[model samples]
Target: MSRTEATGIRTVLSERLLQFAADRALQTREFERRVAALPADSPARASMGATLSAAKAWEAGLLWVAWRLQPRSRIGA
Candidate 1:
């Protein structure tokens, strides 16, 4: 109910959101590497590509939610 508690909760949520975004980015990078190392005709490469696309989509969604949750004053800066 207190302003301090509300800010604390927001901070924690922001940190967790950032962490999730970072983790997804890392996973996407790894998937790209795996896809690159696979043969051109490999079915697994196609699967990895799809996985990477999904990871990027998830990251974008998280970023959008985080942006919406941020304070108005902090949104543009």
Candidate 2:
């Protein structure tokens, strides 16, 4: 996350963002590991890309949901 994102008082979904990032990273690492072990002519290359795309999409959806649930802070309360 950027400095503003981490330090903002506007982080209403910080926890969900953090978890989503962690999960995405892990999935990426696992995908890389498996892809590296696959043969050059393997038919699973397409599958690997599909799985990675799905993981990314899922993470994005979670972020969207969290954003909708985000709280707004009022000034001079």
Question: Which lDDT tens digits does candidate 2 get at residues 1-77?
Answer: 87566546346466667677678878787877888788978898878878878887777777776575555566995
How would you encode candidate 1's per-residue C-alpha lDDT over 1-77 as one tens digit per residue?
99768877887787789888888788778878868988999877777788778888889999888766664455665
Per-candidate local distance difference test? 0.80, 0.72
Best by lDDT: 1
Reference-based TM-score of each model: 0.76, 0.56
Q: State in Å the error of residue 67, model 1.
A: 2.7
Q: List the residue pairs that clash in candidate 2.
A: none
Q: After superposition, how far is residue 49 of candidate 2 from its true place, in Å?
A: 0.9
